[model samples]
Target: QEVVKRTPGEAEFHQAVREVIDSLGPVLVKYPEFGEAKIIRRICEPERQLIFRVAWQDDKGEVHINRGLRVQFNSALGPYKGGLRFHPSVYLGIIKFLGFEQIFKNALTGLPMGGAKGGSDFDPKGKSDNEVMRFCQSFMTELWRIIGEHTDVPAGDIGVGGREIGYLFGQYKRLTNKFEAGVITGKGLNYGGAQVRTEATGYGCVYFVNEMLASRKEGFKGKKVVISGSGNVAIYTHEKVTQLGGKVMAMSDSNGVIYDKHGINLDTVKLLKEVQRRRLKDYREYHRSAQYTPNGNIWDIPCDVAFPSATENEITGKDAKKLVKNGCIAVGEGANM
Candidate 1:
């Protein structure tokens, strides 16, 4: 209640807080000292929040401006570490929501890293290489002052990927005049990126789900799967699931969903999304037997397992009902949703 009152209009953040607080009831009862120290209140507040203006010129010599945000939620364990998003949907509320979730996520790993999440409302979908470069440079110009190898290290998220990270890192090096490779993650392997980093999240999600299925004395072999989103997480999830003998029947993007009865071709998906940055609808060009539905709900499809790897709140009550009605035995989340 206090969180909502304090951060009015931030529905995501409020929901995140409520979820966490509700879960902590038993813990609070077990350890009243935590409540006595007001730890819960402190945890609800971010240590620092940075918001700035990112201005750059487009290819047409037109100036475009966007808001950049960084919420350093906590650093009790170690330095601040999180991903930098670049989707137009990014805002303080979503950033805070994600960062708050990160606090628990990092803690679960038992790693010496804190929680933070930063991003801008800039959409990189249609931007040219030069335009993206310029926007990244401008975004980093303000971002670099507060981030460092030992302070806040950011990785890729959503609209921010290898290309955007390269531009941001280049600008950071230019500003600081130091080859601080540890200042960021998800760099190109030639520079300092770790191998398996690109496939880790997606692969890990499938691996975790495989274990969950194992608990029920089942596996991914011959299981029909439907994954939402064709981005990094969904693409690799499909690949790993297929390698484990699961058939991925559907994958989606923001525009629509693609259903392929013969199983989705990961190679074609990579070509369209990773190489060409095209929409999932173009998938029909390669697989003539596949079906494409514009703005369709992937949950409508029948599957043994469903993976929501797209944006937040993508699976609604109706979608959940349909998935349950379609015989979906399991649902794994590969995105923050």
Candidate 2:
């Protein structure tokens, strides 16, 4: 109630706070000092929040404007570290919610990193390479003032990937006249990025799920998996699951779902999504047996395990019920969802 009152219209942030508060009963009871010192309250509020203007010119010489955001939620552990997402759905509430989640995520790793998130509502889907570069340059013009290797370090998320990161890093270097490779992660290997960083999130998720299944004397050797989203996480997740002997029956994009009975071909998916940036519907051209359903409910497909590796709040109550009814034995989240 207090969260909602303080941050009206920020439903995602409110829900994030409520989720943490609701889970703290045991910790509050055991420590009591945390509550007495108002640590929870401090954690709920961001250390700093910056919303800025990102104005760039399109190919047609028309100027477009977008709002960029960075919420330095907490730095109790160390410097702020998080990804910068570029999506039309991004807002203050979504970034706050993501930053809130990042605090615990970093803490769990016991890494000397804090929590922060930065992004803009810019959609880079149809933009040309030069247009994307101009946008990154304009964005970094303002962003460079606040970020550094020892301060907040931003990486790629969703619409922002290696291409975006390269452009952003180039702009950062050009602005500061310094080649500080440590200022960002997920850079191309020719730059300073660590190898396997691109596959880390997806591979790690599968490894974590493997451990969970091991606890129950089960594994992915013969499981049928359904992963939502055809982006980085989903693509690599499909790769790792297939390597682990699981048959990934379906994968989806925002527009539709692709169902392949024999299993999805990662090579073809990589070509279509990564290189060409085409839709899932084009997948049928490569594999005749593959079925593409436009705007279909992926949850309706039966599977042994489900990976909601898409956006947040994608799996609603009804979706959960449908998955259970379809005999989904486990669920592992590979995205913010």
Candidate 3:
């Protein structure tokens, strides 16, 4: 039925869907139970796709508008679960990829969740806090009606964080007139958020590496590590790595990388990232001992471990080869690789 509905202009979309469906053909052929389950025939189509216009007022009192989307791809296994990204790079294609990937990721986690994703093309950077709050509230106003604890649960991703989640959840509660604790997962601790939830992804990566090393009677103790990005994952990764007795050689942002061979002072990194909300380039002004390599490649630095805690495809085949050649024994992907 989905194939019959495809048109020539949707050629690219059809091709992508077909590729995924084709990949499942082998599995269905190998397992008669999967065929009995009718999984292959239902592989590519999304359960629901929502597109809405988000209009809000800027700090200047100028009316601004943007498109918002929520692709609730599948919910056969459980309720919808994914992140809300806000960036100019967002589009239907990108949201589909993210939602599709979340299905398998959730399955692997052994959590009661199915695939879904949502976001807008609105960039939160350089905007006033009030402006951001207004945008988040507007986004949530439409989104809350379709999501809930047992229905759908959204979390933080990319441009969405504690601030964004706060505004979103506040708006949700105000509109629904109900305080559902599990409606969102990344809320502040005082508001029923789990401890270490913010650091879960990064810290879990380190923990997995530690376990793998223990299996081989090795560890990260006294080893030099280089981590990319200055977000929550990167900042917390630097913290856990240093706590486990490893020196983080460098950290980077989209603009460039910062090389601090002595060690990336965790507190100072947090100050530059969390407190100041500035770019990684600003780290140099405070910690002069740390070498600031503007617009540089972080993988070029020598290290025993490498954590790419940034965006998708940030580390390519060439970056992998460089890490291997530089003697990096362990690599972790905090976000999409």
- Per-model TM-score versus the true fold: 0.99, 0.98, 0.90
What candidate 2 gets wrong by more than 4 Å, as runs, is none
Candidate number of the best lDDT: 1
Per-residue lDDT of 130 in model 1:
97
Worst 10 residues of 2 by lDDT: 1-10
Pairs clashing within candidate 2: none
Model 3: lDDT to the true structure = 0.83
Tens-digit lDDT track of model 3 for 1-337: 4653843344434545566676777777789898897665555567888988899999889999999999897898899999999988888877777787778788898978998889999988778889999999899888888999998888988888898999999999999999998988889999979998999988988888777767878888988999998888888888888889888999998789888767888888888777777888788787788888778989999889888887776777998899899999888778763
Off by over 4 Å in 1: none
Ranking by TM-score: 1, 2, 3
Residues 1-337, candidate 1: write the lDDT tens digits: 8888899999999888888898999999999999999999999999999999999999989998899999999999998999999998899999999999998998999989999999999999988999999999999999999899899999999988899999999999999999999999999999999999999999999999999999999999989999999989998999999999999999998889999999999999999988998888899999999999999988999999999998788789999888889899898999984
Each model's lDDT: 0.94, 0.92, 0.83
The CA lDDT at 37 in model 2 is: 99
Report residue 103 deviation for candidate 3 (angstroms).
1.2
Say which candidate scores most in TM-score: 1
Error of 1 at 69 (Å): 0.5
TM-score of 2: 0.98
